[model samples]
Target chain A: MADKIFRVNMADLTTSIEDIPADWAGHGGRGLTSTIVSAEVEPTCHPLGQNNKLVFAPGLLSGTAAANSGRLSIGAKSPLTGTIKESNSGGTAAQLFAKAGCKALIVEGLPKADNWYSLALTPDGVTITEEKELIGQGNFAVVQALENRIEGKHGLLSIGQAGEMRLASANISIKDPDGSLRSCGRGGLGAVMGAKKIKFITVDPKDGKVAIAKPDAFKDANRIFAKALVDHPVSQALGQYGTNVLTNIINESGGFPTQNFTKGQFEGHESISGETMHDTIKERGGKVKHGCHQGCVIQCSQIYNDADGKKLTAGFEYESIWAMGADCCVDNLDHIAEADRIMDDIGIDTIETSVAMGVAMEAGVLPFGDGAGICKLLTEDITKGTGIGRIIGNGAGSVGRAFGITRVPVVKNQAIPAYDPRAIKGIGITYATSTQGADHTMGYTIATNILNVGGKVDPLTKEGQVELSRNLQIATAAIDSTGMCLFIAFAALDDEKCLPALVDLLNARFDLSLTGDDVVSLGQHILKTERAFNTAAGFTSADDRLPEFFYNEPLPPHNVVFDFSGEEIDTFWDF
Target chain B: MKISVKLFAYFRDNRFKIKEYDIDEGTTVGNIVDDLNIDREEVGVLMINSRHTNFDVHPVEKDILAIFPVIGGG
Candidate 1:
């Protein structure tokens, strides 16, 4: 069967399989999701209203033997940012959707009644059934219950209480290969899904295979690509320490946001560093390196354990640690891990929620460094949808509005992640100008600014930072479309063979003669298309900026502020 | 000159995390790395007094030097 689009209408509980549209044929993952959302969703519609549509797309190379090509893209008009948003995650869903011959899954129209539903996808088509048992459950419970309800191995996407409450920080959780959860943890897409009345969706691809136009060539390209990935030093470090490796390095660079962005470095950084996490994991009988999806050569994820030697969180990442640790001034790794587990179960974006905690702490909701208090709020308030919980769950911008806190570090309503933009000027441009809001993944200038993977840009300076952000954002758009993990970028920037081998894999899979320049064009086109959608949605260049605090306050240690003028930031769109 | 040196990630393997070194005047950052038996190629980031620096530069007294292996993640 040729790849087809699966449409599910909650209004009437109808399902249909349609031919892949010609215009969307060349796009996949973020490209396809953004294109579909741009074309189908009304820009001015309330994100949780009937007019908003949610899209799920596998990357062009997904479901194949290509390494690190299992990321799934989920797009919608964001309830948090009110911009066109695409958040991708690592899981089996993308590969399963591709294997089931599904190019994309579009869910639209809210049900008139309050009944929730679940959609099951197969090679034939989608089947929508009224869902009741898992409606109010957290993601872990839902995944656990479905294991007995479903017959065989299946790919799952579900939301938790936060989603059910329609909080802006709600995230759609994807089931990993090991039954742990990976998340489309940005832009409040989970709330959109919850608003559409979907508790969960299951995908089962039985004896299905993705077709490769040139099998031999594809094999050769994948070998080269995977080799380049595993051979890179950054990849090696990630495997050993997981993404938490950045705690010490970023803290050392004096770009680590601490105590709600008031300081550039954390005093207790050593206690929460990746090295400490790694040692703790080893001592607690946990795996230091684990892959979130199949065929991922750069396994940056890990299984974190508590002092009792039991699993606390899987796929423990740096952003989550930094958000709950340095940002909120909590240094206990176990507390952060427990909070991470709760956020995963609650189906909330950790970055958004923890950053919200930071803002709430600034508001005296709880004192800073209160790890247990943060967890208590996550369980008692946010999960139960209390008034205070809603404020924090709605995200950093919402908390700032609710409490009149001025130092809320957000761009376009989305919480800024681990990197402090004040000390790192290139990332500041990315935070200001990103179409989907303040997402580090939209363009990780850290590679150049801090890590020196691509090259040095002197992160503290304004020179060449705008052009650096523009080029990276363009390249990131293309990469996000390919279903490859963004970690491939470290190798892509430094290794000469990496990007070419990736292009070769795409060419071999699609039987096309695409050059590197064509990849660049695809990236540029995706960015422009998404930008046009945001523009139609009433976003102007004025929206492309950081919070005033970033410009006004000088972070300590370095004592540098994000000094880029509005005109300098506006130049990011000159490309 | 008393220079405080901090090592992170794998650079701390079989070595101390932080130590104060009273070194001869005009000693470069590379001398500290070589004295500590850390490979130059394995160093991802090198900084002194919270400023990114190269190995060739000489360190002043009371300078805090931080060394890390190549590490990248979002």
Candidate 2:
């Protein structure tokens, strides 16, 4: 078995070699990262300090042409949320890492100085090179520099000035096939990389092709999985409209956080919804349905263009649209597209940055719907480190604090994602209780068959949300470890056969026997571990809650307030 | 009888861009959706006169209808 571990210590510039435990071979990717992070990192320590380690791993099915399986996860204690965080991204890195014959790469400790550097990995070993010249460069430029140095095709993960400044909203940008930037953009993990003084990582495929443990079984399983993804209605919608498909649904549900959550529905939501984006791209002849990673059957990304048909940004997904469009009250798609480009280039978490801008607007820094002004602030002042831009880059909670805004929507310092908890009660429960604050992916409720694990209740009822959230969190934890994209859960929920097929694939790949029940157990274990860590870190049950405004001011359209009491919310994890 | 209908997301691009439809009086949101040649399964939630409505809810003149997709987590 080709099992190896690569460890880099920034404090002393030391590299060590280790062997992976035999049990870990089956885990791979996200599973490995979660395990390692939980075992090694101290939960309550300063996230940017030497106590936290950043772990990168590819999925169990990655590197073998498993459609949509080329995902890499970065796990760390979040500087922004003060909780466990794992952000997954699609690019060439995971495939390259798998090909290099290493299951995981762990970067531990912190550099002693403010110097900038990049890590270059080859078949031989890892090399740290001075990249001071590339300091302060945006994500696009940083990727270009690394690409030129590596020769031919190379996978990269780099940060922009926002990370360099240790901004909580920073993101780690991964180079896409077209030289555009995609990111593992949440939980402020980029700041952790920045704290390590590492500017970028270049993974060259010169390491060779990845070898699958069971090629025949992998191929069979992947074929079935790929077909399922292609046939699913959710996949079809995503392929057609990209992520902006949620705009109308969220608005209709009265959960599209508008004007800084002062309102729920955006009046001009249709103009910026996924359908509008698709039409605009078609009329301009721009490319739609771009893939984030190789061999992805459901290409739910897009290359948005301006009126002149010039490319503005790639993969302007739903979270970015809600944060910039509905949250900020901007209806114009072009403006939202431009803002997306700015966030990508600047290496900022689009969700956090957009929410920060909304909060800033609420503070009267700029009027809501001032899309042009927001763009200028991000592109010009933020890069230049101006006064307002500095606070905006700091993230939503910080910006809210700096401006004395009380209505900021956040939990544990992390700005909430696109979903409004009041309308989608189950999702709100997830957001409130997730180890990572206000994160949607921690327990996605929208498009999953959650087994009715929590007794069935009306979608509009608050009765079973806490239980549903708990079940989803456990299931999500298990899925994350396999390095499978959480999107797969959509099929897994609806297709009773899908989970068993996935288990079979895992068993064949690792040459071990496992069942669907084992997957559930594994997921539960991960959630329990994360919860223990958070508890040890001093987070109490009270910390898991929505903002008071959610309780007092009912959201529009539905007019449903966040009604779950703290005691009821705490009952979620009783199982 | 005329009803103001706004198609959001993919529905707008696919079938509702060119012109607004005026259906017979007492027509339901379901009927208008059927008349527009839009697949009912693809539409997730239906709103009539700014209130949440089931697919079976009938429509009236001057009533505004909004339809959206079911799959929405990002």
Reference-based TM-score of each model? 0.99, 0.94
Q: Model 2: per-residue lDDT, tens digit, A1-575?
A: 36477888998888776888776655666567777888899887998899999998887766767677778888888888888878888877877877776678899988887677788776555777777878888888887776676668888899888888788888898887788888999988788999999989988757477666677987788778777767766777788888788787667656678899877789998799887888899899888888888887778889888999899899889999999998999998899999899888888999999999999998888899999988999988787778888789888998888988888899888899887887778888888888778888888774432112122334467876777678788888877766667777777766666677777677767776888788888877777777787887889998999888889888777778888889888887886
| Candidate 1 per-residue lDDT over residues A246-359, each given as its tens digit | 998889888999999999899999999999999999999999989999999888998888888888999999999999999999999889999999999999999999999999
In model 2, the runs with Cα more than 4 Å from the true position are A22-25, A448-459, B1-14, B17-32, B39-43, B48-53, B58-64, B69-73
Worst 10 residues of 2 chain B by lDDT: B12-21
| Worst 10 contiguous positions by lDDT, candidate 1 chain A | A566-575
Q: In model 1, how large is the Cα lDDT of residue B69?
A: 86
Per-residue CA lDDT of candidate 2, range B1-74, in tens? 77677776566655664345677766777887788788887776666654567667777777777776545436
- Best model per DockQ: 1
Q: Relative to the unseen true structure, what is the C-alpha lDDT of residue A144 in candidate 2, on a scale of 0 to 100?
A: 72
lDDT per residue, candidate 1, B1-74, as tens digits?
88899999888889989999999988899999999998899999998987889999999889999998889988
